[model samples]
Structures are given as structure tokens and as C-alpha cells.
Target: MAEYKMTTPLTDEDVEKLKIGDIVYLSGTIYTARDAAHKRLVDLINEGKELPFDLKGSVIYFVGPTPPKPGEPIGSAGPTTSYRMDSYSPILIKHGQKGMIGKGKRSEEVKEACKKYKAVYFGATGGAGALIAKRIKKAEVIAYPELGPEAIRKLEVEDFPVTVVNDCYGGDLYEEGRKKWAKA
Candidate 1:
């Protein structure tokens, strides 16, 4: 419905302003994590241990990138199916995480958490890993290196394209779009 250009470490105000179906180009630091990394992060949280990165106002991208070739900050980097992180997302949102970047549907709990916490869920173009990789300006493994591609990485991205799939106001583009098309 609208377009926005946002930077990472997104504040509550930044996320609250977004609406489902709005296009977004994100530029700033985002952390990468997939299933394994998410589990570890949640485990750490439960143990009251220090996390590798600060969660406050942060955006997490659900991706496990391919190994880079020479002179590239990252390789094919695409969003993974978001549901895999559903079990852990609400907890992260509660900890001050303001945004999530991934693809596909999320659970009810995750959606409620977004609304309750003033966070948003963004959907990256699936199957566009190579194109998305180009937007990443820098990447460094921040934790769980043994997991290889699944390792948590800190990434600096520039104008990385995405769309708002869910917003703080309880909007869900996937559901809304489906209903719209179903009625047509």
C-alpha cells in the first residue's frame, strides 16, 4: 500500500509506521540466523547468558548463505521459510527485537508478538538469493561458526528489498492478499 526506506536497529516508531504490503528497502546492520542459530540464541536467553549481539531495536534476517567467492562479502543469500523460527521469534520480540526478514507465513503467536511488541515481519523475495546477496555490503560470522552456513553473521546491507508481510497493527499481507484474490 505504501513504500518505505528503513535502516536497521529499527526503533518502535519505525516498525509501528509500517503496514502490510508496503515495500521496504532496508539499509543498515542486520543479523543473520536460521533454525540452529535461533535455537542457540533462545537457549542463551533462557540461561540468562550474554548474547553475541544486542537484541534491542535489532532486525534479524533468516538466512543461511552460500560460501562466498573471491571479493564478495557474501554469496547467494536468500530468506528461508520463516515458520522454522516461529517457536523462537516471540521471545526475541519480547527482548526488544523490532523486525524480522524472511519469507512465507508466520504463526499466530508470532503475529501477536509483532503487534504487542511494536515489531514487524518483512518478506524478502524468495529464490532471489544472488540478487539479494548483491545488497549485502559486508558480512562477518558473529557466532556458531561450526554451523558453517548456518552460523550467525552480522551483515551490513544497502537498500535490500523486502515487503511488509506483517505489521504492528496486526496486518498480514499473505492472508489479506489471499482473501482479496479468493473473492475475485
Candidate 2:
């Protein structure tokens, strides 16, 4: 699969070029939201209330980072399990959210949303929180401070590595990988 370096606020053209298993090193801004935050986001969408951040062309990371150490921008910032947000992901994707960063398989609904909306699901390395935090240049709580670590944060990342797990064209790395390895 091809590898690409992309910055955030991705366009349709950017999403279109990716396929499952492609390595992508993303740079620029991405937002943080775990299950609690996702529920809030979907609630806002259903109520026609303005979201904290624009959904169009945005990448949301499924993470609730730890407290930052002295002089650092963020603490251990690894991906959370993606499936927990599956219930809310389609709504976000339908509203123009372009990418999601997390680990594990997504539901059929989420994959369908990616296919229908020209969005992608990216999988960051699990258990590599400290290593991943090195790529994050900045992080600040943008909403829902009461949720503590689960609060939404805006993050500036540079060369943050991820794999395209589900693509806009209906490719799924988890399925393909199982098949490929099983045959071997």
C-alpha cells in the first residue's frame, strides 16, 4: 500500500486517495474525544446546536490523554478503542467529520459512514502512548472540562503515524489482514 504524509482539515480528495493498510503520517490539528465526548457531540448534532469545533474536514482522535508532565504539551496520548464510539461516529461522519484515529475494528455502520461520506478511520499504535505523545506538539481542552481526561482537546500533531483501517472506498484492514494472514 502507498504511504502518504497529510496535514489536517483533509479534503474529499485527500480521503479519496487512501485505501485500507496505507500508512499515513498525519500533521496539523486534530481533536480529542472519547465515548463520553462522542455522546455529547451526537447530542448536539441531534439538537441542531453548534458544535465546539467544525466537523468539516476535521480529524478526531479517540483519546483521553493523561496529565502533562512539567514542560510538556500532553501526557501519554495513545488511541482508545474505536468501537466504543461506534454508536456516535456515523452521525459525526454524516456531518462532515473527515477522519478518526483510534485502535480496533469499527462497526459496519461506521464503515458504511466512511464509505458514504468520504471519511477514513485511522488506527494508531496501541500501548505506545508515550511514543505517540512525542508527535503531539500541543494540546488544550476545548470543551467539556468536567469530564476530566475525557474532555475534548485540540491537539497539534506532527508526523503522527497511523494506518488507514477503514477507507472511503469500503476497504477494511482488519478483515483484509485476517484473510491475508489466514491464507499464509
Candidate 3:
């Protein structure tokens, strides 16, 4: 119901202020990790190995961008289906990850983790890869390069648009919106 402009490495306070359905324009550093990258990250955690990037206050974007063209910082970068990362998300949240950016419904465990860990789930426009790519100012493969487009990339974004799909207070926009329209 509100709009917020946030810069990443989001804090507990930052995520606490958000609610489902709120619009957000996120700027600053975010990491991209698709399913393959997530599995590796989780595997590292389980092995007690140091991760490629610090997890504290981190926001992970679930995307596997296409190869860039002539002069772009990134190619078409859109959110991947969120459920694919569900199995790994709670573990990441437990380690101080404060936000996630992706599309589609998440599992109950993910939602609970968001509430328990003061994290938030953000939804990016599903088919707006080209438009979203314009918001990414810089991108560099930080880990798992062999995974190709599924590699973990550190990204600097500016005013990247998103919506708060699930918030720390147990709000879920997908369910709320569906219930609101179900009777119409």
C-alpha cells in the first residue's frame, strides 16, 4: 500500500518497514543467483566453507540473464520462478540474508523464514527483462562461472522496480490480491 526507495545490503529495520503490496525501487548492490548457484551456496554453507560474498544484509535476485549485446552492462535480466529456490532460501535467510527478488509464489517455509529472520520477498515484473536490465548499472561474475548464465553475479542496480510480495510481518500480497479479486 506504500512505496519505498531502498538501497541494498538491506537491514532488519529496512525490511521491517515494508509490507505486502508496497512498491519498492531498490538501488545499490544485489547478487544474482539462480537455482544452480543457490545449491552451491547452500552446499558451501553445509560444508562450513566461506561463501564468495558476505551474506549479512544481502539481497539475492533470482535471475539468469542472457548474454549481453554490444554495449550493455547486462543482457535481458528477469526474475526466474521463485519456487525453484525455495529449498535453499530458508538457509540463506538464517545466515543474515535480508531480501530476495524473484517472481511467483513461494513455499510456506520461505514465508515463515521471512518472518522469523526479518527478511522480505520482492517480486519483479515477470516479462520485463529488457526494461529491468536497464536498471542494472554494472555486473560481474563473482562465483561459479562455469554455471554460465546461472553463475552468481554481483550487480549494482539503480532504482530497480519491485513489489513487496511477502514481508516480515506475515503479509503476502499474492494471497491478499487473489482474495480481493476472487469475489469480483
Candidate 4:
């Protein structure tokens, strides 16, 4: 249950020290990619094609934000359910993706990938899109503009908040909380 202030392109050392239930205030860059974009990314990797963004030390947020209002960088940027990306996640992690931001439980395979690759799974507060958008200082669709909201966008964030749902050492906050309350 520690709170840390971290910057992205997070290193393996940075992710390894985090434990499930720890809170993180992340600053710096992150990229957005939903299920549609994820499939494309995996396909590129399998083909040995170059990706749009460097996967090394990158964090991907599972979100497709609404169009920004006047003078705003983004709008209603909320996390999508994580399971939809489960199939592509381990592949990305193996390629150097260090963290993810989304809601809901991750698949066991995702957990195993995090453990094997020294990555982490983070959960953002769902239904808090507008609030989350405030943390995003800039956003630009870097690829697949045809995918609309599902496009890969490079984002600059300051103090973006998240919780460690799954840690590299095999800790899972969701399962731990369930067991704790079950015993109470």
C-alpha cells in the first residue's frame, strides 16, 4: 500500500518494485490503444514490421476518448474493460510494454506475462472520464486515424492516477481483496 510518483517510459526496475495495492501517480508519456488497435499491433509484430511507436518502456491506456471541447486537449477519457485486450497484451509485454492502464480483471495469461517480463497491470477508475481527461495535457493520433477513437494516440500526462492491480511478482490486488473480505 505505498504511493509513488513516477515518470514514464518506466524501466523494469521501476515496475519491479511496485506491489499490488500500491497507488501510482504517473507523469510523462503514454499511448492509447484499444482492442482494434491492439490486433493491428500484434499483426505487425508477427510480420516483423516496424510499429508506429516504440514499444520499449511504453504504457498503453485502453481508452477511446470523446472529442475534446474548446481549449481542451481531450474529453471524457475513461478506461475500457481490460479483458478485451487480453489476447494481445502478453505479446506486447514480451515486446517491452512496461505497463497498462484500464479497468477490470486481467486474464491469467496477462498476469503470467507481467511476471515473466517484469511489467505491471494498472487499473484506472472507471466512469471517471472527465476527471481523467484533466490529467491528459496533450493527445495526438499517431497511427490508424481511420480507427477514429480507437487510433493510437501519444499522450502527455501529468500526475495521471492509477492503482497496481497486478504486479510483476505475481501479486493481484483484486484477488487479495476478495480473499481478505471473504475471511472477515
Candidate 5:
């Protein structure tokens, strides 16, 4: 129930304290990776090739942003639906990815991986592109630029707001939140 201020470096304790409905303004380093990047990463793993960056304790944001306006660090950046990358997530979780940022439902196996690995999934408000883009301080494409929107980019962010959709303990906000409205 604690309201965290913007720009806090969330610890394991801080992340663990967050629940489905709780809001947070995330800061610090986050890496962007989507379906194409994920596929490449997994392929690298299979080939025993080194990845572009260390996966440990990193947060992978599932986003493909629009081109930035003049002098802006990034453009309309927001989370995409998570289910598209469900098959790749469990592997990343097993490899030490601690947080995922996206929207919509995930597969049961991904949820199970979160429980087993002390990982979490966060949901950014869908369609809040302009508002979300303001939080990004800088953007650097680290891998797969050919994929364009699906490319992996490293972002330095400040006060990025999001809701806890899934936590390490098997709590799911979307499921519980929907049930309340569904019973109407």
C-alpha cells in the first residue's frame, strides 16, 4: 500500500511490496525488447552465443515507439501486449530477468516462472503514449536495429508510471480486477 515517489530504485523488497493495484513511477535503467529481439536472444542462447547485454536484474520493456519529435529523446513510447512474447519469457526469467513491462494477459507458464524466480510483470496504461514518452531521458538502440520498432533499445528513464499486473507470489491484477467488473 505504500506510495513510492518517482525515481526510486526499487529493491527486491520494494518490488515485492508492490501488488496489482499499486502504482509506481519507475526510474533508472530499463532495456527495451520485443518479439523479434526476443527471438534473436533465445536463438543466441541456443547457439551458446553471448547476448548483447547481461540479463541479470534487467527490466525488459515490451514496446515499439514512434519516431521522436525534434529534440525529444524518444517518441510515443508505451507498452505493447505481453502475450505475444509469452513463449520467450520463461527462458528470460530463468536467466535472471527480474521485471517485465507490458500490457494484457500472460500464459500460465510465464506466471509460474515469475513465482519461481522472484520476477514481476508491470502494466503501463495502454495508449498513453505521449505521457509515457516524457519520462524517457535517453534512448540507445543496443541490438537489432533492422527490426526497427521491434529493435532492442536501452532507455534511461525517470518517473515512469505503471501498475503491478503480476507479482512473484502468483497474484494477478487483471484476473481479479476483471472479475469485479464482470459480476455486474
Candidate 6:
């Protein structure tokens, strides 16, 4: 795999260079969306209305952060469970979304979508809230602020760490990596 430096509006070349289990320090523009926000976004797409943000080459982070401390952009930002969003991801992927950042096992449909759409899913370390929050340089609510933490926030980050969980070629690190260490 080739080395890639993450930047705003990542390209297929950036994503294609990543392999399962490779760590990345993502920078540039990333959009936050959770369960409630995803539901609304998918609904809008179904209605043929404009989405708050473009999906093409975009990365969606599955996070609901705590209130920021004074002079801070955010607090305790971390990936949430991904299964809850499985129903909605295919639609987003179909529309040109390229990447997703979250934790835990994903549905097969989601994996299929990644393969079909040439998208990737990254797994952020769970319980590393403070560490993760430090990587975020700025944050601002772009939509759905009434939903509080569920609001879609635009975050600019630096060296935001993640491991590639699912790759476009159907590689899954969590399962395969564990099996590699499993006793015969």
C-alpha cells in the first residue's frame, strides 16, 4: 500500500491506497452525523430534496460529542456503533459518499455497498475520546443543531488516527486480524 496524507475532499486514489489494518491520520473536512441525523438525511434523499452537504467524495463520521469545554472546539468525540446506520449507508454510498468512520462490526449490506461503490469504512479506537478530541482543530454545527450532539458538525482535524476496517476489495481487518492470532 502507498502512503497517503488525508485532506479535504478525499479522492479515490487516497482511499484506494489504504489497506485493512493500516493506520491513518486524517485531516481536512469531515462531517459528523449520527442516528437521528442520518434518518433525516436519508429521508431528504428519498424525497429528492437537496442534502445539507454533498455526498460525493465525502466522509461521514458517526459521532455525537459531549459539550465543548471553554476555548475548546469539542469534547470526547468518538465513533459510535455502526450497525444502527446500516440501513441508511447504502443510499449514501450510492450517492457518491466515499468513506465512513465509526466503530464495531458492520452489516454485510454495508460491506457490499463499499465493494459496489468503491468506498471504505474506517474503525476509530473506542474509548479514546480525549485523544481523538485533541486531533480536532475546529468544529462548527452545519445543520440539525436542535438535535444537540446529534447535530451535523463540520470538523477540521489534524493527524486524526484510524484503522482501515473495511476496504473496497472486501478485506475485513478485525475478523482476519483476530484469526491471524488465533491458536491453531
Best by lDDT: 4
Candidate 3 residue-wise lDDT, 49-152, digit = tens: 99999999999999999999978789999999999999999999999999999999999999999999999999999989999999999999989899999999
lDDT of 6 by residue, 1-184 (tens): 3445687577778777888988877888899999999999999999999999989999999999999999999999989998999999989999989999999988999999998888899999888888899999999999999999999999998888888999998899989989999998
Query: Candidate 5 local accuracy as lDDT?
Result: 0.86
| Residue 182, model 6: Cα distance from true site in angstroms | 1.9
- In every candidate, how many clashes are there? 0, 0, 0, 0, 0, 0
What is the alpha-carbon lDDT for the whole of candidate 2? 0.95
What would the per-residue lDDT of candidate 5 be over residues 57-176, giving only the tens digit for each residue? 788999999988899888999899999999999998888788899999999999999888888899998899898998899999989989998889999998888888898889999899
Give the worst 10-residue stretch by lDDT in candidate 6: 1-10
Mark the regions of model 4 whose C-alpha exceeds 4 Å error after superposition.
none
Residue 41 CA displacement from its true place in model 5, Å = 0.9
lDDT of 2 at 180: 84
Displacement of residue 47 (Cα, Å) in model 1 is 0.7
Candidate 1 per-residue lDDT, tens place, 1-184, comes to 8898988789987987899999999999999999999999999999999999999999999998999999989999999999999999999999989999999999999999998989999999999999999999999998999999999999999999999999999999999999988954
TM-score of 4: 0.98
Deviation from native of the Cα of residue 11 in model 4, angstroms: 0.6
Give candidate 5 misplaced runs (Cα > 4 Å). Answer: 5-11
Native-referenced Cα lDDT, model 6: 0.90
Report lDDT (CA) for all predictions: 0.94, 0.95, 0.95, 0.96, 0.86, 0.90
* 53-156 per-residue lDDT for model 4 (tens digits): 99999999999999888988888999999999999999999999999999999999999999999999999999999899999999999999999999999999
Model 5 worst lDDT run, 10 consecutive residues: 1-10
2 against 4, candidate with superior lDDT: 4
